[model samples]
Target: MPMSEEAKALRRVYQREYRRTHPEQLKRQRECTRQWQRQHPEKCREYQRRYWERKAAQENK
Candidate 1:
């Protein structure tokens, strides 16, 4: 089932508070993401290219 807007908003607030109180966890998460990107440079570049292409297409609409 899909969450209602209020439920989604509350979840977002909870996540923001959790991240605010867990700096180390956020740092580790970012480090893990960076490591994955380093191991898949070509994939990351392709993803970025596609992302910008979509963004540009949306802007032109």
Candidate 2:
């Protein structure tokens, strides 16, 4: 099921509060993300190429 706007807002507030109290967790998450990107360079390039293609198509429409 899709989240309601209020539900999404509550989630954002909760995430913001969690991050405020969890610096180490956030640091670990960022490090994991960087490691994944380094290990999946081709996948990242393909994702970026598709993202730009979709964005340009949207702008031209």
Query: What lDDT does the true structure give each of the candidates?
Result: 0.99, 0.99
For model 2, residues 1-61, the per-residue Cα lDDT tens digits are 9999999999999999999999999999999999999999999999999999999999999
Position 53, candidate 1: lDDT:
100
lDDT of 1 by residue, 1-61 (tens): 9999999999999999999999999999999999999999999999999999999999999
Error of 2 at 30 (Å): 0.7
Worst 10 residues of 2 by lDDT: 24-33
